[model samples]
Target: MSTTISRLLVANRGEIAARIIRTCRTLGIETVAVYSDADRDAAFVQLADVSVAIGGEAPADSYLRSDVIVAAATQAGADAVHPGYGFLSENAEFAQSVIDAGLVFVGPRPQTIAAMGSKIEAKRLMADAGVPVLPSAELDGLDDAAVQAAIDGVGYPAMIKASAGGGGRGMRIVSDPSDVLEAVAGARREADAAFGDGTLFAERYVAPSRYVEVQIFGDHDGNVVHFHERECSLQRRHQKVIEEAPSPSLDPTTRTALHEAAVRAGSALGYVNAGTVEFLLAPAVGAGSPEFFFLEVNTRLQVEHPVTEAILGVDLVALQLAVASGGALPDQAAIGAPRGHAIEARLYAEDPAAGFRPSIGELRSFAIGGPAHAAVRVDSGLAGGGVVSRHYDPMVAKVIAHAGSRDGAARQLAGALRQATIDGLVTNRALLVRTLQHPEFLDGRADSAFFERNDPAALGAPLVDGPDVAWYAAAAALAVQAYRRSTDRHTAGVSSGFRTVPTGPQRIALVDPAGHEHRVSYRF
Candidate 1:
């Protein structure tokens, strides 16, 4: 049976919600946005055709409450519900709940999500399907001695990860055998808090591996097509900061194999809608073929899908809607070859110099370029006066630049980020700019440990006010003094701080954004 949706309710918030709303508008479908109290005036809430207040600010009280979201969708007369990325986006139970409520869930089947939900199960399934998977062990059934044995079997520098949740939660790297138990415990706690499941697993950690993920789409008929790949090797804290399309590290043969493997993965599960299959590509040595191992499946649209969209010249959201509605995907040949290159930088409210700590405060000023011939495209859920509280992800905007070449794309994006005016809270804008210009990144050799290898201070150095900045401060102070002199009653007709001839030096104190005061001296 074909499922048709007229009005859709987006069961999430922030930029992804806004992103879905934009696509829905293009398709002439009305959108319903659910928001917490914290996002009452958020951009997505304002942009949606209708909006509902779900609950309090915390995710559990609001976004994670599946029943409440379903009720909101029903009340809003939405025929379908789209869980944008994050929150309940990859949740199998939530997807089932929506299906049970007779609303079309705009994503893969609940079974598909369940299959790929756990890292262990997904890897086993992929391995069974002739897909290469990293060696891993399920620790739930293993004793302490057995766990240590398994770790030793997998070798050192293995990763203990929470199989239930992603986003780097409940994850730890165990280099020493003595640290295994503590790492497992910590990962389980974090996993439980983040995903309500504390199931842990261990995987062989491959160093100097490139993180590349293929965007895939499947129809109800079992037809699946791959939408090329994205290079996401540049990351910090296990989260992607910068991503680009058409991995520079992959040759045509490897690229074709990657695409075929991704298609096999999707078809094996009867996958439907949009999903991503991430892989770790070890560089080829001495002209040998590169080795790629299955990482995990993100059973929903990825944050870095825009780069794929840019290169492929297709709207993935549109495809998601079509596939979710029981429509067929275009023929493989019609998808066309990828062209040029695209790069995306996630701008966050954080201080990279201070260990990338989240910065929360009002955005006194926010300015970015709109779409132009060759300009950057900014996707943001924030406005100039928006308050970036600690309630959600600190990402303020996603700036993407498309060009005819990889270097061109990187340069354009970096220039755009450097030109952006973001005030109030400290941001990682300068860090992103520096990363795009870094030689390692430019040469496409950046690995998962890129941040660990580079100096955070150097990355955020551009954000530092240089010595010449004092001149601007002094000039601003002088301008203010001039204005006061022009407005004062006693000094109305006289130029204050001005003598017929030059006199003693005048000292003007200016406060920097970091609250440092600089005294400028000048003789007039």
Candidate 2:
């Protein structure tokens, strides 16, 4: 409450930055955007009232440079800083810097970020606060003897997670004791690359696990409320592909218990603004019956916030602004009433069938055709034809569907995806549609193993261009030949374009991704 916060600085890029910008504009708050050299002309930059060029192309020189961001905020005369997901959002040091600079950090307190930024520290804090935690122990002198002793106790399937890493980095699953050392070394190297810390810990690799996370909000007035859970089961690597509100597997009693746990955890931290409590749920495991154990706290808005917004009709970004500015949380009984079902599909410009390799190119054409009802909404940061660069994440847009039931919402999302078209860049849109329509998915039986169990090529349309179009092109070529050849003796080389009834043969070569050519030959 010490600062008035009339102006705010968005300290990230892409769709999330634009998302927060929209909310700020609605609140009559002036917005300032910080951009790297590459993102100087990004949509979020244009949408902001003002923009600052912080550094060069690299994230470290730009987005991750806390000092640069703080200086930019100071120069822009912004009263608050909103680190929209990723980058420096979870860095407690960055939060502290913003505070020292006399600007409100529109997120959890610095202490909360520090406590949760490190997975080891967060686990210990949760255990100390009586939150349900998984079976795990920190590794300190992880030599051969130590590894053997710990692995024997933790069992065959264990996870080696980075003490100071997240977002899918620095984590490896060891199904056999023999692979522990190698996996641990790889995890340590990845952790060093990401967090400058190579330290790791061992934890029971929860089986049949679902990434269930709770949305919670707190204010300076000490009031906190839970907005239900999201089931992020369908993920590639550790990136979430599909997310739904109110996890399908949870019963009424379990849902209440989970919410209570989240509230208690948040109250324990004196958390403020918007945050998510992630849990590793090994449903039907002994000791815990389809229950969730505390994983970590994301002390900022999550990328999948729209699902919660759709189900609860709450604008979390706005809530963050209000809470950061000393406003009290809304009446819990009235605000926590979640209705309807919401589903979100992240339409990334990646080729899932191609080892999920990142595809970067110009979007020749992009259009999303969906139901014109209020229940359907498509949030995007790109125009019809924007360039997708390797410099950033491949996500172009998020398509969300809201309905009265899970099946309805899911079907709505599939139909919307089917009508979408993008010409140039390779995307997993078709794959998403296939996943949504898969029999197992429709029946709510999809798990993390679903993709591996199914055929990748069959997961989407076989060709980048629809099967019908390819066949249509071929049929059109055949028809042209059929019309000219009266005897119907036309072959690949003896095409309809043989104006003088050619005596020789001609071949047309078409190259494919595998560097092979298919030659169509005909003789006239």
Per-residue CA lDDT of model 2 for 1-524, tens digit only, reads 54567999999988898899999999999999999988876778899999999988878889999999999999999999999988999899999999999899999999999888788888888888788998887776768779767876887689889988587899999998878888888998999998999888888887667778999999887888888899888887888999999788677777888888888889999888899998876666575558678888888898889999999988889888888989888776877567999999999988766787888878877777645534577777676657776778888898889899888998889887777867677788888988888888888777766777876546754344545545544544464457546666536465455646466564455444434444455554
Number of backbone-clashing residue pairs for each candidate, in the order shown? 0, 6
Query: How high a TM-score does candidate 1 get?
Result: 0.93
lDDT of 1 by residue, 1-524 (tens): 57777899999888899998999999999999999999998888999999999999988899999999999999999999999898998889999999999899999999889889988889998998888988888888788899889888888889998888788889999889999988888888899987788888898888878899998899988899888899898888789998989888898899999999999999898889999999999868898889999999999999888888889889898889888888999988999888999999999999887888899978877877434323687788886548786889999998898999999998889888877877678898888988999999898788888888998768886454777787677887787677677678875666567666667677778776456787877764
The C-alpha RMSD in Å for every predicted model, in order, reads 3.1, 5.8
Clashing pairs in 2: 492-521, 492-522, 493-521, 493-522, 494-522, 494-523
How many backbone clashes can be found in candidate 2? 6
lDDT of each: 0.87, 0.82
Return the lDDT, model 2, position 393: 84
